[model samples]
Target: MPHDIISGDRHPEALPLAEKVREEERARIARDLHDELGAHLTGIKMALGLLRESLARAQGPEQPLEQARYAEQLIDEAGDAMHGIIDDLCPPIVEFGLAEALQWQSRMFTRQTGIVCRQRCGDGLDELGEFEVITLFRIVREALSNVAKYAHAENALITVERQGDVLTLRIEDDGRGFDLASAARNGSGLGNMRRRAQALQGTLQLDTVQGKGTTITVVAPVAR
Candidate 1:
């Protein structure tokens, strides 16, 4: 009988191998959805646009004109939905690099809610791997999403820097602070943030005082 079988302890490498397989499958699916569905949505939008133009030039009846306009609107909506799906599947965060991604995200946040969001970065971050960069970006994004939804904040700041052998990500918002215990017991957002931080072998700290503001800081080892 093989010693590998019937052992109380499982193989040390099994879990990592499984995760690797899962990640590969996810990438494949994301690529297919981006290429196939994106092209299909583009074609539908173009066809609808041409039809609308043709109907306008032909001086069609009022009913057909209204129907054509409605169809075009639906097509536009579908296109927007497809883009949202693609973004969720595989965001361009990693592709654009961390600093650029952070800048873009902050700009969008500022534009959407009129909240002044600022970002700053330090040196030597280029050596960080894609996984580290994307994970940190996502952590910051989730923090901002929470701020916008619950913080009612007027100003926010995101700072990223490398210190010695560790990298730090900090997000601060000047909004109404919540009781950490209450939020943890009531919702899973904070819990999920902590889990993501732990996944990177990092530590997450939250600081908030009622009527003051909230700040989230995460520190992780740099993947060299």
Candidate 2:
């Protein structure tokens, strides 16, 4: 067993604390990436734009003008990539809440992977704490990522429902499912999802059949 797993089992209370620390670190890194690298990228794009204008005004070599325009285009792409990375590190749950974030994530997944994805969210989820909201968002994001990378599914669905004080999150896909035993031995994604669920005092359930599909469900109390 991994050392972290052994430690978590021995001191279950430490799991949530560890998760909190990891999230804080991710947020800090995302902020730095945005404030530093993002600013630099923007400045470079502005400089390239100015160069292009100057070259055009002077009627100088067309080659330099073309190069400046190309550089600006590359900078735009880099800016977009940076924003994606920042979103992954620390999503906009604080700004848009979990429901909107999940919807955006599903759309992005479909756009990026060409896999149709949809979200269905129920009521009574507006009162969750920041920790619970972010944790749940990460769990679903990881699940969808797995689907895109390994599930080879054509369609996916994310459902969030609340029944009384209990909240349920489910991700279903219509793709080839693998043997749970083999995946347990070969991948850490499942374990990561389990750990996040544990951090929430929640349960993670995975149901799958070879050549059929897979569904990951998480149930946790909403009263906390």
TM-score of each: 0.81, 0.82
Residue pairs that clash (backbone atoms under 3 angstroms), model 2:
none
Residue 24's lDDT in candidate 2: 91
RMSD of 2: 4.0
Provide the lDDT at 17 for model 2: 90
- What do the candidate models score in CA lDDT, each in turn? 0.77, 0.85
Cα distance off (Å), candidate 1, residue 35: 1.5
What is candidate 1's lDDT per residue for 83-115, written digit by digit as tens? 776676567766777888899999999999899
> Compared with the true structure, what per-residue lDDT tens digits does model 2 show for residues 31-78?
999999998998898888898999999998799899989888899999
Q: Which ten residues in a row have the lowest lDDT in candidate 2?
A: 1-10
RMSD vs true structure, all candidates: 8.2, 4.0
lDDT of 1: 0.77
